[model samples]
Target: MNFEIPPGLTDLLQEFTVAVLRTRPSNLEAFAADYFNNLNEKKNGPLKLSGALRFQENDTVNIIEPSDGHGSSNEDDDDDSFVGPPSSYRDRRKSVSAERYDPEADDEGDYTKVVNPKSDEQRRRLNDAIKHILLFRSLDHEQMQEVLDAMFEKIVDPGEEIIAQGDDGDNFYLIDDGKYDIYVNIDGKRKLVGNYNNEGFFGELALMYNMPRAATIIAASRGTIWGLDRQTFRRIVLKTAFNKRKKYEKLIEGVPMLSSLDMYERMNVCDALSSQTFRDGQQIIAQGDKADCMYFVEEGNARVAMVNKADPTATVEKEISRVGPGGYFGELALVTNKPRAASVYSVGVTKLAVLDVHAFERLMGPCMDIMKRNIGHYESQLLHIFGDKANISDLR
Candidate 1:
């Protein structure tokens, strides 16, 4: 009988090998278990592991999540061979059990409405404050307005417990006016672990992953906060994500090079995209620079320019072509793993969807041959303009 090794297993083993060699953990069994566990959680959704269990060279204990008490002592026990003292092991486990969860699981729930008592001035200020937060930055204008309306204000007196450790989290809070202290319960005592002031946010870990609060937050002064309840937060964030994917999928579908990709492949490409914007005349990709990411024009246009690389004193660039919406550029470098062949500048106020090189290699594997065949066509156009003085190979 003949058997074959799965295609994905090779890549998985290669990744695991690199991780093992980099960390040099004393216990391979424990490290493998922890690595695979983290990988699985990542596949399901975003996961934030306790800092104590991060795969640093000096630390090897697994990240502890809230455990069901029914498991046997040994079943729940840390590996005896794990580096560090026994007390240290126990203390690490005592940190907030930040659970892993799929945010999409709650997509069917109705969005909760919070009464907006804020005046015009307050609403403007709140919008300014949260507009830059990573979680809210990707939301569209309409969704952002919904977020602002759902977040209600809360007033807390000095020394009030905002959230208790080990309790289920219901709201994600953003501080507006005063200070708050973060504490972790260790050995039946509250230990001051960190602090947050105006503009700082907390409780997201629990709400994001359905985990218990990892730490207790107490108001250090008479402070004001903006809170979005769990149901509303999930509804906004997950819906925005879902809509963005559908939008990008449609964009990917229209690109000529990616036209050959199947629906599932196109969806994977869509998931890897991130959005960026540039002002008129801003340099998007510099010639001779190593390429790390490729760009697709989502809105407005970009100018592709190239210089005579063979002449050291040739500083002027000639506009070679324009890339309008639904068109893509910067892929030559990603396909060849070389320096950019030409500089790309924003023609006007441009919005771009980007995919990094790693994602390009992983998701665009099926399109590699098609991309390579087009490289000659691209170079020929450059040759027509520069008349062989450009030495395009060096620029590539």
Candidate 2:
């Protein structure tokens, strides 16, 4: 039968083969089968296989084809016959009886008993696959191996909720097998948001920000996953050559509007700015909606619009301006604490720093006191910006 191996699986097989050869066994075929079987029993049957070849029991003495198939023979077949100590042999027998069984027949409902034995190469492939997923696409070979030692793997059945929206997320996951669907509840209905495949990652935003899960992820099929909890992931990211938060703080301090603030107050402003991400075309702030926070553009672009009051019967949307990186918007929300005068929608993948009312209150308290002391200075500035039409009655 024709079978094709995926690039990922082939790499895994190579690793497994190396591991098995380091602890060489007498019968290569038997060792391979035993190793495969053990992995199957441990991982259940979610593991996939390809390029498998088996030998008939009676034809063991005949020359078996090597993986390269160049007519080489096993010269040590006779001399390398396995002879285990009595105690070891008995332990093996007992383990086989206790742990090796058909998952379908087991009353205990354990799912991992169905793994068939695999060749040395296949075992290596499985191990490589696990390592590859733990490291994901960003880490290099050496880093990947280190991560493999620290990571843990698990198999989950379909319909399992890996993370729930609104819950504190402490772990991030990389898919090794099967698929998953992501959803967010909108207007009382679960709306499909995204899908994940092998090597795909989710729950990263929560890990970075320590916020609640923004969406719920459900296993779409029997899946194998490699996950690292928040503590470990944090250590890895923070240990990198560049710290993202520190870099962002330095950039924010350079902005003219924030230059008046000292280093401590600037840090407080940064702390107040919550990390928010949105997909293209997603509405960030609705027109005429009660605004509670100011937003600073960190990445991507957004269109600002206000209702065109020209036609009273029909609602009109007029785009006023486009805001992008280093540009700030929604300052009115921070000051007036009133409804948003305009709506903003993402033009592409967008990241924003949102400063809410509570954060603004805390950070602006001392600054406000300073402004009150120089009331005439502030009043002149406001008058120059907004003429006689500007209302200063609300300030008192």
Candidate 3:
């Protein structure tokens, strides 16, 4: 059948090719021929879009959104596509646009999806991916749902950049389908550091402090992902995590030196902490070794001790303190950046929430005031008396 090409229609196809394919226009005749054929034919299959159809251009920062108000379907053939563009190009050249979508026509819901048909699967996969990440553990079911409302899914082809290194972070992502290689600029060149597949997630660090993406995450193969915007993240996840962090503030508040920390300081402390578990007799701190962390026991018991410097090879010195639930230790060595005055080991299986001095200072630099009070006034005389006692009981 002989086909008549519309004026500027060839140009429009070229523009779409360049914008969506991320490739220079080539063989316009072949591209136009195929696109016209697909537009007029009623074919049934998934459609694959090559690049973001619409993205802000010539900007210093990269923040892309689907220009067509939707992304192409992931089809067998990687072409920028949508519900097979209306029955015939000759019949609808002026009206055929990338900006509109018909869900009834879109086999796979596009980028601006409001209600997901595969919501059950999406929720389960999203929760599973997020469960192990410390940053999201505090969110309750309702909050998780609110987060769900703000998220949407997308599929990227192999070699596509999911998140670029050194870009302003605008979204957090969870992998739902395939693998992606992680890279970070090391020294001067981009270095492959790691890879993550289904159920793995990244972009948390960027949200935590609004910092530039630390690493570039590229799709190792065609992959599907669920993404939440930075605004939704701060509104739902960050707010919830901060609220949950307050529940642990009492643990910080009870510590004499840390008692003076205000509520915001306490929240920062909670954010800086990590939960840990130690089996019975597991060494937590080594006596006379450089130590710079503190802990708060949340479950079970742990014993604190110091090396018997007098003998140099003693099995264990007298137990300095038996820390039960809610008790904390490691304040002395961590704050001073000195050799540990004592060693700590789990008595039975114990669980503790721990924070390193550097983390604490990084989260709140002024909080060093708390450490100064701990080491200079409280631990000074005790160290003079017990020599290397790891616990604060010597002062009591």
Candidate 4:
């Protein structure tokens, strides 16, 4: 007897099977009803069906892919899907958490937090593993501690499959010990792509973007790995981003020069800014150099000093002023479009929110008027210090 499965039915069954294997709900009938309803909603929505997953507000399950001999062969067909860095052992190199993130819905109250205890040695190893991961790098001291608490260790045996190709992504894995082989399906044949030994991470792209696993990871020897559940990862990532934006927005709003910018304009400025840090005594800006960016002090302080260029042999710098938190500098060069008149250095361990000249011109149009209005005040200070040697071409 020949039993034929319709192509549409095959896709439906494939999705259902993956969902069930991952979720493993106690009641199959009830799970099926909810699964199909959610699946239908996702399908009918504006987004087309592909390698994308939606992280619901209330979902907590560590469902992995079942190797039922129906693995998709088209998983690795895309160009550049196999490119990797030295420790990269997977398919694709997309930016971490590139999907549109809505932090408001990712509140801690929405789901039960997972807290798996680890010994001091284990905690240190896990910290070292995830410290460099971009998805976890944005997390602060408290958030990082939360993440470490949520992670549980998984012991892998030789030849055991940790992640199967085409599986629904549920957890992000970081290697704590041992090695693993990576394989991808190419032309219906599994091809060895790469390996992760002692250090590396996989399954992040799938969790970050809600996409299917692009490669299979199998342990080559007994090893222990740390895993963070999907829900916690998303909540922490989104919430941290939201908080950082709000913090920077508050700082940008405090700048008197940019007070004229409306609410929406202020938000745009927040998006354009990038955080920077400098150790004590580090030179942030050099005098007479072309200024392409401005800085907003977020924490600590920066000293702005005027350098005497009249006597080239006797190079000297005089501290003119200090910029504290919520203060800004380097805008004069961007406004006057000339050489930097003063050099700025970090007074202590300083932090800054940097906005480049291009972003300044585009988003600071309204603020530019205010800056030009204060041009006389800036010029007067320069004239007071340099006397006849004051050159407007060198800027204020």
Candidate 5:
């Protein structure tokens, strides 16, 4: 029950963890669930790894590991009983539309090896296929469309291995018709674990890295599937993030406050930003509220005001400033969680690039490191600008 993970596999786990983090930032609970399942799925059947993180979907993540992850072997796990005969497979195969893909048909002028169904049913299913995964749920409608666009259909025959447990993963698959039997190898023998039918997906982790497949999936019948290669999948998954980062780069380029930073440093700041939108009358930052994030206006307008503490319900607020596209507020908040000095509200509908405290620190680490290395030089420059005795030790 206590299978020790090989030392070499540690790197694979770390790499997998980073990909999951990038795909879904700040959701450690989801990471734990997916990570453990990843290791468990790779377990050599009755012999399993015990030290992987233990968790459930809704449960709080726990760092403790169970003593044993392995379950006892069953005599009923025989491969013959699990895998039905070729004739039985043909019976199920008859349920699917064979006209969709002709085995004898040659692709004389087609761009793909598999033939797509004439109806829109496959496209609808492909869109619905990823709805259940948390990472996909984070995507907006347009971003999700990119994922669907990246995918293409593949017609597979019965008994063919869609993906083998030890093979390098280049594609993430979603079954469109028929089924696949999931199998894991234990001591060079394949053992059936489960089955995937229409809409079921696998190989999502491949979008991040080309690790070996955790389990083997064999076609139970001549079936249709939609698959996205690693390159296309990665582009879809990272499109929003990279797109926003590029947008921020352009936005930051126009901000005079960031002019002192080098291009690379400016990019670091841009990469930390996350896009946000505000409805009319929505308060972006409230007076006396903790300042944990800042915003850069992408569209529309906003008004800055100060609350009248003497008359809490006063109809008139002290209007301090008005800013539109390419403008920003809460710069001090990125450095520290101090109480906001004023309030900001959307004048109409507004879109903004927001950077929370964590992201600001993370993407700006390199810039901070450079400052740390040149602290003495910076201190002298500040002192020269002010006076010989100017205080610069606690610049934070």
Candidate 6:
């Protein structure tokens, strides 16, 4: 008899076969053999009942006597009806341990273990977290991923030394969570310098230069850190920072006094000024100290004090002048490379733009000559008014 399989029945049979292959097997050899035989019989033989069997292939069936066939139909049917193996054997092997495998076990053992990070769906979350940890921004997606992949997380317990002072610096760290105390050896004491919290970073100066750790970073609380090794951190920082410094140099060149400086002179001034900072009430150019730089006050006020040493215990010390924003002081030091005749101290928090003596000489050579001539003219005017009784030579 010929069998006709509906389209829906054929599809259902195929899906059922796949499910059986995945889920049922005591002896894989016997299961495979029976599966193929049944498939072949369905393809070749006609079903006595229509739609009872699905045809996956087209071939003619040749009925043979029981003695001539591999097995009797009844025997084949009994074997076919046998359900193979436990369901647990058909289930996929799950990783039991990461270190080693058990050969007899169904578990995947060491093979499946991995440091699972954010999945594709959670990539934005990972990126945002990394963004907060990184010191510099402006990295594109691909570059950011490269950086993130290189970074590894670490946990530090309270009082642990994250980085020791005076040690040769290597890796730079970004705080992912918790806090750290920064300490530096000041006046032979380990002074608490500052505290770093989440998203804060340290060891940047090491990446810029192969300098020793300027301060020790200790965990004030149980902290988590994500670290990028020196090589990678340096590559990113150097490219960005160099470009930024160039922009700053251009801005500095716009200043009137420094505008006349040549590229080499400006570079020297830039290097010299890199180490300079001013605090409130800090004396920049002390009286009688050999002045090596000219300072342009970018912000805040400075008082210029002139002392009349002739009257050592004078009730009131002389106030020569005061300089505020846009004003430059210590130009005489740059011009003459002589001891400062007066002191200049910040009246409040100040930012100073400094030009070194060499830069001044190179940029303002002719200007210095004009200033000397003007000083002489003022001295003559003062001499005329004082009638030779007052000495005016020291005024310059």
Q: Evaluated with TM-score, which candidate comes out highest?
A: 1
Candidate 1 off by > 4 Å: 1-112, 246-272, 276-294, 298-303, 306-327, 330-351, 355-381, 391-396
lDDT scores of the candidates, listed in order: 0.67, 0.52, 0.56, 0.66, 0.55, 0.51
lDDT of 6 by residue, 78-184 (tens): 11111222343235332122121112232333332223254564455446665643234434456567666666678889998776655555676766678777554
Q: All candidates' TM-scores? A: 0.57, 0.35, 0.43, 0.52, 0.43, 0.35
Number of clashes in model 4?
A: 3
Clashes of each: 0, 8, 7, 3, 0, 1
lDDT of 1 by residue, 1-396 (tens): 111112233224324443443345689788877776656553544543332233335444432221111111111212212222224324433333434334335445454566667789878988888875545655878878888888899999999978766667778787788877765554455555456656567666566545566666788899899988776676676445555666797788779899877544565566567799999999999998999999999999999998877778788998889999999999898877788888999988999999888778777777888888888888788788888575768524
The best-first sequence of candidates by lDDT reads: 1, 4, 3, 5, 2, 6
lDDT of 1 at 384: 88
Name model 2 segments beyond 4 Å from true. Answer: 1-242, 309-314, 365-396
lDDT of 3 by residue, 101-216 (tens): 12123332233423344568777877776675555655667766767767788989999877665556678887787877765443344445456655456665555444556556
How many clashes does the backbone of model 2 have? 8
For residues 357-391, could you state the per-residue lDDT of candidate 4 as single tens digits? Answer: 86687677777777777677766776687676665
Worst 10 residues of 6 by lDDT: 63-72
In candidate 4, residue 282 scores what lDDT?
99
RMSD of each: 12.0, 24.1, 18.9, 13.6, 13.7, 34.0
Checking candidate 5 for backbone clashes, the offending pairs are none
Candidate 5 — which residues are off by over 4 angstroms?
A: 1-139, 145-166, 172-235, 239-242, 260-265, 308-316, 365-396
Candidates 5 and 6 compared by lDDT, better number = 5
* Cα error, candidate 2, residue 337 (Å): 2.0
Pick the winner on TM-score between candidates 2 and 3.
3
